[model samples]
Target: MKKLVVLLSLTVILSACSAQASTNKDSNKDDKEKVSQSSEKKQTSSDVYVPNPQLTDDRSLLEIGQAFKDDKGVSSLKAIKKVNETYRIGDVELIIHDVKVIEHTPSYSMIDYFHGFTHEETFDFVKANIEIKNTSDQPVYFSPIAILESSTGEHRDWEADIYLEELNGELAANGSKKGNVGFILDHSDKEVEWVKIFTSDLLNEEQKVTNKAQEITIEF
Candidate 1:
């Protein structure tokens, strides 16, 4: 009888050990699956692109540009020009921080926006980092680049701006805005040597022009 009891106890201990081991194995698998799902979710979120991101920080803009380039397989052969030039038209101040030309082949998701500007699968565009400030004590209407003319004789109006940060229109008193403005070039492969920016006339609350428009040029 004692021998039978010993054998039964050994069997029960083995079964318990086996059950614990199986539970541990199942738990590890669940943990791994959860981790994989989380990773996939993060990757999917990052893959979504925003063309007209409302961002003011320069670093964020650079990251967004990098993400766009990566997503669209874009490239740039020319070096970026750093033009830290500032122009003051009456109470409004405009600053151009940098400019670069990029060749982009929009992905299928981005075709809608690019189709409005170009029919080609691949094209080149110019992007400029800029800042505008209303330095007066009252509100005013202004546009940093009402017209953008390239040295290659290509002209683009404010309506063609792809960045669309709302940098144009009314600015509050002593308020400032900083962001990027981009335009698709007509000649996709042409080299741009310089660009001339025509700013809109400063207007008062009555919508009357209080200050004349200004023309500024930047060399690349």
Candidate 2:
């Protein structure tokens, strides 16, 4: 009888150990799934493109007009330079420090419910890091209005998003500011040859496109 009781006790101990091992395996599986879900959420958040509120409400942007009129580019872009090279537009000195092309995988798009703008179309963006300096004695206003010209002669305009902050206001005499602007274009397999960043005086609302307008072209 003592031997039988000892055997039964051992059986119970073995069963308890087996159960604990099974529970541990299930817990590990749950932990792995949780980690995977967390990683997916982080990836999804990074893919979304949000717009800037201050620039979004600006009515002046609508007045800028379409990129191509009569199948011809309206903006008279000046010379094109590679990244890190400086170009001049009137008295303002501008440089495109870097250029990056961003692609949204899984083809995500959005409908801005509040603003009533539909960004549902799948598109890619070419972002340019720019630096603007006022070389003249007078204060000049800098408009973040520009276009991205592809090697194939395609022209994409400056898209107003959170990354393209407000460079619309005035810059003091000899003052400088740095920021990024993005151009919206179709998801292209081709590479961009150059980028054109144009600036106009906000103070002169009547003459939207005039001789005072200046442009800086950045080649890839």
**Candidate with best lDDT:** 1
Give the Cα error of residue 43 in candidate 2, in Å.
Answer: 31
Q: Write one digit per residue (lDDT tens) for candidate 1, span 16-107.
A: 33334344443354344344444321122122233443221222223223434445444443536767767888887787777777666776
At residue 185, give the lDDT of candidate 2: 48
TM-score of structure candidate 1: 0.68
Best of the candidates, TM-score: 1
In candidate 2, which residue ranges exceed 4 Å CA deviation? 1-82, 105-122, 152-154, 158-162, 199-211, 214-216
lDDT of every model, 2 decimals: 0.62, 0.42
- Model 1 clash pairs? none
Return the lDDT, model 2, position 120.
30
Tens digits of per-residue lDDT, candidate 2, 63-155, equal: 212121221112211222226656666666666555555432211122232133225333345566566666666654445443345554565
